[model samples]
Target chain A: MVRQKVLLIKVGELKDLFRKLFVVILFLTAFLFIMLSRFDSVAIEALNKVVIKVTGPVMQVVELPARVIHHVWTYFYDISHIYAENQLLRDENKQMMILQNKVRTLEVENQLLSRLLNYVPPAEASFMSAQVVAESGDKFTHLLLIYVGNEAVKKGQIVMGDESVIGRIDTVSPPYAKVILITDINSKIPVVVERTRVRGILSGNNKDLPQLIFMRSTTDVQEGDIVVTSGVGGMFPAGLPIGFIGSINGNRVEVEPMADLSRVEYVRIVDYGLAPDAELSVDFVESEQNAR
Target chain B: MRDNWRENLKLFAVHRIPLIATLMMVFLFFMPINSVQINYFRPVVGIICVYYWSLTRGYIFGFFSAFLVGLIIDIYSSLPVGVNVMIMMLLVWTTDWLRKYFSMSSFGVNWLAFAIICTAFLLLKWAFLSLYFHHLLPLAGSGLGLLSTVMFYPLIAYINALIARKFLPQERIDE
Candidate 1:
């Protein structure tokens, strides 16, 4: 009986040792993964894609209850404000009618001038709408997983919310893609002040407002000036409205994104085909046109 | 013999309750609530699960289960790969070490212990991320997340305890 007891104790000790060793190994493996991710390896990307493909459907299923609740709450809120909204829209619509006529005249004059100059128009952007299926709602990161549904969305393609630029596609797995929002720390976009044309790099700090950096010392940048994509990098097209400069303290300028990123339910994945290597092949373009 | 086999299968299913619960919490963490306040102050549900399970059902939940929970969170989270994994594993290790005190203590004492441990975990995460990016990240986000998680512990723990009492076998609960 004593011998059996001793053997049991020995076995327990061995098991405890094994558990400790396993924990150490797990810690090391996790650190190794963090290191591998820094290099942005293809293996890690492939692993991410496989995981996302499996979990994307699960996320959609889990999100149904939340979606229903949100819609119900929004319905009541909208009903409460419907009268005021209608009045506002009527005022905006009358102004838009006047602007529409002026814009039409300008469009005809611009077309005639382009014909005389023999100008080749830039490739028109094609877009597909996607519903946000999941969000990284933690304090540390701001990313959204959108259901692409077999539409070809490549990494670095621009994602727009409502009427303005919100983010770019960070990863694309078939049927799902991840958007790194402009408020995420990893986001960086080259932009120019619309009024003075002073260019700067907009950097996200994981805050509501992303800060503009790298502008010249003497650059005249004012609060409330519009910021647009500078097209310095081929990744984004020129003149895409990003946001308005909300504040300036010395060299630090913060931009408040035009899109209410918090309430984004649907987004447009635009293929500007602006990247040097991102141009669609003539056959693909023709097929797209035919399909359209 | 057939009845014995069926009993063993039932036990096996019961044993997985903690893991399944933790996985569900992970899904909840990623749910798109779309409220700015909720988004910024979201609790670290996975950490809470790891801590609670490791403290109460260490033999069943195990380090491997904690690792798996962390891996799932890492896959879903936009933070650098393995950050959550490392944090979860550390939580398991710490909870395992302090399980005796935590198990013997009252709920308030256990919560205090968790609050201290969770604060350290979030700070470590914040420090690691700041180093990774080579910039000082704003700490208010981590501060708020920690506050949310600490405040949320009792509710989640209560739910977990109820699940354990209902579904888990007495032997596992005693362990």
Candidate 2:
């Protein structure tokens, strides 16, 4: 009885010690990760990929029901507007044919002009489409997890919605990738006002509209000006549409992205295989008419 | 031996449901359907689960289990590895520490305590993120989220009670 009592007391004491030790170890590990992340450790990045690869399928399964519900809801909503939308489409199609003719003539004229000037066009980026699989649940940051990985995709590839640049892939793993939206606080894109040709940095503040920053005071930036990628960093291709100037607050200019980020169902990941400092050259240009 | 095994399996079934349910809620939060605005307003479902189980069923989630769960949440949320780990540990410890008072208090009183704790949790999370990122994160969305989470407590509590009544033994409630 005495030996049993002694053993029980020892076990209780050990449990208490273990609990205290566990707390210290757990907190230390967490803090270590926080510090290591500041340095952008490769191991941490690898771990992130592993976690995503394992969890991506689980997330897809969980999201299936909600996606179905959304589709059904959208189906009903679209059916209600189908007749009106079809009429609008018909009218738009007539206008589009006329616009297509104008574009064709412009394209030929531009090709001749570029040939005369010996101007080099940029390489057109090819894209692999991926469906958005999951999302970060945090209220502070804007991130999307998509169903494509580093195996076929790389970080810094431009993510697009139709014709507009929406975000870039931040990280990739085997079966999943994370896209940091232009509205994330961490996002910064080199952009230019298409009309004025003035360059500025597109910065996100976790708002729906990202701000254009670092423009020279003398730069002629106007409200309602279209913004496109400047291709300064070579991470994104030149002339990819970004957004339009929304409102100017003193030096601050907010840009409203043309892509409806909230409604984006799938994104195109594009690779522009230019060197980081490579400038646009004639060798990069491909003419569809010449190819034909 | 068969009777003993059957009893053990029954006990596991009753005890495991809350943990499983909490995990399912985490998965639901990870789904892509939420808009960016709505994503910011997600209720801390893990806390609600922990609070409910600890209060009614006398199941005090141990520190390690809480840590593991937090890690899963961190992985799911794409947070810095340890952020949710620390937050979840704090939640479990606080809930465990206050379990005694909760048992003695009226439902309204217990809920008021939850309100206070949830508010503190949100504040702690905000402060941690600000410190981690070295920037002032906007608080308006999280404030709205807190309101919704608080508002959701009763419904979640009712659901928890139903589960407890249906699956759990009377001894757990009495204790």
Candidate 3:
């Protein structure tokens, strides 16, 4: 009886030791993981790929009920206002038709001017359409998971909603890719003022309106000037509509993005190959050879 | 011998409640409510599950289960790997420790304790992320998150109580 009692005590002590050891290991593991991921280790990337690939489809299935409910509510809301909306559309169509004709005439003239100047337009990029699956964060981080995987999608490709730039593909796993919204704290885009061609850096402040930085103090930028990608980095193509200047607080200008991030349901991803700097260097070499 | 086998089966069936509860909470976490304000105020429903199971059924719910649930949340929410893992494990440990001193019979006390725990959790999360990102993120979101978590605590607790009564009724009475 004494031996049995001693054996039980020994087992209990061993269990207690194991539990303490396990907790220590967990703490170490978590700390090490956060540190490794902050530096963006390769192992973590591979593991993220595996996790996202498996979870992508499962999350879509899990979110179906919520999506269905949202769609139903939208349908009812749309039906309730269809008559008024139809009347508004009729008025909009008449205005748009007049604007369309004016735009077409200007486009023809601009094409002629460009042809005469020997300006070769950038190659047209093909777009792959994807449905946004789910959003993963709250106020601090804005990330969206799209249904397309790495097979058809590449990192750094621009994602657009309704012909306006929304974000870029930051990471992709098989069967899923994450789009980092332009309003995310980490996002930065090179943009230019449409009216003055003044270049500036559009930096996200984790708010609805991202801040425009590095504009020249003597620049002709105004509160309502349209901003478009400058294609300076070769990462994104030039001429994609980004947003408009919303407010100017001192030298800090805010941009209200053309794409409504909160209401984004689908997006088009376009791969614009290489930055404009590469073309500039090529043109410089050709001009030097002609001079020689 | 047959009676013993049946009893074991029954025990196995009843013991799955904790795991089911964890999964149900995860499902609730991902259910999008479509309003930005509501989304910002998204409750940490999984934390409630972790606390509830740790307090009521600590025997079956352990650190590893918490770790697994946390890992899943991290992946689903695109949070850095191991962020949620560490937090959930800490929750299990703290709740396990507190359960020793605090009895589950008083609902009011448990609810108040949860409010405190949830507030601490949001502050800890803010600190950890700020340290990781090497920037000072504003605490507005954290405050809203805490408020939402506290507001949703009663409803989540009620649902969990219902789940416990229906599935793990035999286990709850043992306390």
Candidate 4:
């Protein structure tokens, strides 16, 4: 009613309303905060509840196409494996002989080993297949959602792609899980060169690869030096594959992710078990990105 | 009596649209969908309907309903709390305010306004969530996202307007 009367009043009287507008905006914001605080998690929780329900069916609908294709593919593979192992090896030997002029995969491994042997840890990481239900590459945080929840996964479980380690499961929602992708700028991992073991902080920088900062000036990092999680920070299991160090510019090292974000499917989550970790001990060595 | 039944049915949908959108979100997030099918369609549809109603009829949505829409998006999308709700509320208020001032007699004005409103809302949501997670995530994929959203806006906006026209009536807001 006050607003109605103010509207009916002359334009000159509205000048007072400017001061009132400021007050109203402040009051509105305050009211919002009050309402939000009162409800606790009502808003986000309410929305997520609905979305999960609605999308539940849509997700089912989406599954049909992939499931059909996968079934067909499995059938084909099953038929091919009908032969015994000796026969299969004999048949493949002929195939390999014909393709003997093919490019050698060992050559690549040898090159990789020479560059990485210095820092390579003997620990082999395991993988568990998971489907992404959510993907947040929102710059502030890069998170991926997996279909496996608490029933299938636990906290501190290491999530990795085919090529390298992603991030640990920070939080798990029932029926759906959130994967904090290593590329999220806030993700901090203790990593060292797979060749030199010159330890540094593997921090996400809103780019595909995290930046390796605070490498010793004498670090043996090169353009393609492999980078792996040092497990120096107890968050990730030590020596899981992280990424390969990209071009090394002085003490600063940029990394290109071994795991491809595009066409990423079937993530492997290692059931690293629930070991409570205190605050990380590795120092956040002040680096160039922070200097900026 | 028949008309009353029809009206009741219509009302059910209006209120349930949020619920329906909420359900759609759950399906998207909770259940496993193959990566090939994931799209922003659900969130886009929910916000568009909410936006349409808020602009044409602000009385029905109220602040709480708008806030609910945001909360829904956050949950289904697994975003930080209060972020999407804040964006939805801002969109509703801005759209409602513009409807009062601009003679949206033409579709072009409505379309342009929708573009601007959606852009602001998306940008704001990204900004806030980014700040909150900035310390934890490396801010990857931020720069390319704006481009995709702009391209997606026209497609989603057209479909949104269509959905709004099909389901929402001009009288629904005034009432």
For residues B1-175, could you state the per-residue lDDT of candidate 3 as single tens digits?
9998888788777777786677656755665455677777887777888887888777777787788777767766656778888888889889988997766458888888989897887678767777877777677765776788788878887887788778775544321
Query: A245 in model 2: Cα distance from truth in Å?
Result: 1.7
Model 4 stretches with alpha carbons more than 4 Å out: A1-127, A137-140, A149-152, A273-292, B1-10, B18-53, B56-62, B76-79, B118-144, B173-175
Clashing residue pairs, backbone N/CA/C < 3 A, model 2? A120-A281, A120-A282
Candidate 1: CAPRI quality band: medium
Query: Which stretches of model 1 miss by more than 4 angstroms?
Result: A1-14, A276-292, B1-6, B173-175
- In the range B53-143, model 2's lDDT, one tens digit per residue, is 7566545345665666677676655566777778877887787788877777888998899899989987998888788778887787778
Top candidate by lDDT = 1
- lDDT of candidate 3 over A137-160, digit per residue (tens): 444577787878545677778899
Cα TM-score per model: 0.91, 0.87, 0.87, 0.66
The number of the candidate with the highest TM-score is: 1
Clash pairs for candidate 1 = none
Off by over 4 Å in 2: A149-151, A275-292, B1-16, B34-40, B54-60, B162-175
Candidate 3 global lDDT: 0.77
lDDT of 1 by residue, B59-131 (tens): 8887788878877777677778888888888888788889877788899999999999999988888888888
Weakest ten-residue segment in model 2 chain A by summed lDDT: A280-289
How high is the lDDT of residue B69 in model 3?
Answer: 76
What TM-scores does chain A show, candidate by candidate in order? Answer: 0.88, 0.89, 0.86, 0.58
lDDT of 4 by residue, A112-229 (tens): 8877867543345445687765455233445776777436666557788885787766555556666766766546777777787777777766665578866655357777778887
Top candidate (DockQ)? 1
